[model samples]
Target: MDWLGLLAFGDTGWGDELLYGLGITLGLSLATFPIAILLSFLIHWAKASKHRPVRIAAHAYTTVFKTLPEILTLLILYYQSQAVVNWLTGWIVPGSSLSVSPFLAGLIALSLVISAYGSEVVRAALNAIGKGQTEAAQSLGLSPFNTFRKVILPQLWRHAIPGFGNLWVILLKDTSLVSIIALSDLVHVATLAINTTREPFFFYLVIGAIYIVLVVLSTRLQKTLEQRASKGITRMEVSDA
Candidate 1:
């Protein structure tokens, strides 16, 4: 099909739904990224806690999540949510049905998965800081909290950005797994288009194109962030108290 035919909105084509799905995918990924990053930072702090119990708890969380299969985690959430929604509404909500809403289920699942990996990235980034830096800050009389906020966080972010960026792209792609939940996301839409039109190649190719564009643009943006993060070194000037 020609460019016009490829994009036309009708039984013949799916230009409009594709564009809308693209927006949903981008919005979902970006929205969840911040949540994942915040959760990751907290987990990182928990992992780095001075108290042995806190540290052990944090260690167990990351270890457990990292070992989980993604589908199993999501399925557990999906079924639990299904029960809750039906109980609250007094109507068996369709999430437990053969067709669930892919969007929210996928979001919850991918966020959990990304947060798992993101926490590790964050912990490593913070650990990469020379221990002497914090001690030097303490010697100069900055409080523990202030030291982390001013001296440690700035440097830690620079190191974590690259890893976070890569993970963001991966999570964005992982959004496709939501199809099992039945949301009409891009992949689900493509499946519909292919099944109905009997043109698997055409729809699949279109899906690939959309995903490639998103990943490439994201990769380029991350490269810019990587450059910015690398250029300035955070050095704390501490004088003996």
Candidate 2:
């Protein structure tokens, strides 16, 4: 009869259900970010290493991950997690139901997807560092680690923020795909609401509003971070003349 009635909690309404779904979506995004960053950094380094074979292997890693579609990964992980678990341990873990935890399955899927894309962003960022900077740091007798920490990483962020920021927004929207496996993110919650209340249009509209708000806020926050990262560089421009 009313919107709130439709969304109400405690088996009376669906509002609590939607909210819980949103929480899961947010958690999935956040949990993957750190892992993505770590993986990206390591793979980027391997790609950039002086050893030819190492670079080739890194290239293969990035290429494969980047090319593999996320849904494919999700299906594989969803079906295989139990097998993986069983293979690792001779005896079955008492409660490790791989197919049941859609949340974890979605995490693995989106993480692989975002991490592959993030690695490319990181690789380009590393490449943007001028050779002179590294050479100068070496001349100053700074260790490679210190040089990377102090000089290279800062500049790398400045160059990489544009791509990485865009990816963050893209991945935020992409989280909806997890609904297929039934982790019950915003899309699935809205779908349920519409079907239950016979207000398909209204529920969809509400879901759209939620998505718009989240994406807009995220975009603004990313812009602020990018501005901070590029503060020094933005003030000056290189003249090709």
Candidate 3:
């Protein structure tokens, strides 16, 4: 079958399966992103804390995750988490076994890796916020929380945008790694299609094309966000004339 026909719908083609796989891929990324962002901020704050224990713990978290290979992290978390779940199930309800969903497992694994890097981004952004601003806000009778919400966060976001955008692209591509655990993600589905259709080149190429499109769109979206975030900030320009 031609590439177009192979990707066409209506019972004979693998189009539906691929579409479903795409949905799962997007869902996983979307679910992981917000969790990663929240964790990044928390980690950044912990690392910045005056208490030695908090800083030590936060540093250890980032050091461990950033040092480990993502695939290894995923494998360890997936199997270890399942082992814990199984142990609990055996004790709680004899003869009944429970398992972690691949979706949730993949999310947890990816979030750990992404947020490790994101923490650095957040830390840099927070540092970029001048100490004077905090003092100024406090002088205006604003509480720490209000100062962060109104004054610190806005500037931090602008500085963080570029780093977050880069991480977003990496995270999107990293979703393919979930295919290793038989999650039926885009790459996994493509592999199945290739085996069934006996057209490895075509199916793999299709997967590549889909990923390229996603990267392009993500990059464009990132640029849009940077522009929006940097609104009212001065930008340097070179004169051609």
CA lDDT, every model vs. true structure: 0.79, 0.79, 0.91
For each candidate, how many residue pairs have backbone atoms clashing (under 3 Å)? 1, 3, 0
Better of 2 and 3 by TM-score: 3
On TM-score, the candidate that comes out on top is 3
TM-scores across all candidates?
Answer: 0.84, 0.86, 0.93
Q: Which stretches of candidate 3 lie over 4 Å from their true place?
A: 234-241
How do the residues 1-241 of candidate 3 rate in per-residue lDDT, one tens digit apiece?
A: 6778889877788899999999999999999998999999999889989999999999999999999999899899999999999999999999888999888999999999999999999988877887999999999999999999999998899999999988888888999999998999999999998888899999899889999999999999989988988765744333322
- Which portions of model 1 show Cα errors greater than 4 Å? 1-4, 10-12, 50-53, 85-102, 234-241
Q: Report the error of model 3 at residue 35, Å.
A: 0.3
Q: What's the lDDT for residue 211 in model 3? A: 91
- Where model 2 places Cα greater than 4 Å from the true spot, the runs are 51-53, 91-100, 234-241
Model 3, residue 232: distance off in Å is 2.5
Candidate 1 colliding pairs, count: 1
RMSD of each: 4.8, 3.4, 3.1
How would you encode candidate 1's per-residue C-alpha lDDT over 96-194 as one tens digit per residue? 434335567777777778888999898788778879889999999999999989999888888898899989999888777766677667887788777
lDDT top scorer:
3
Question: Which stretch of 10 consecutive residues in model 3 shows the poorest summed lDDT?
Answer: 232-241
TM-score between candidate 3 and the true structure: 0.93
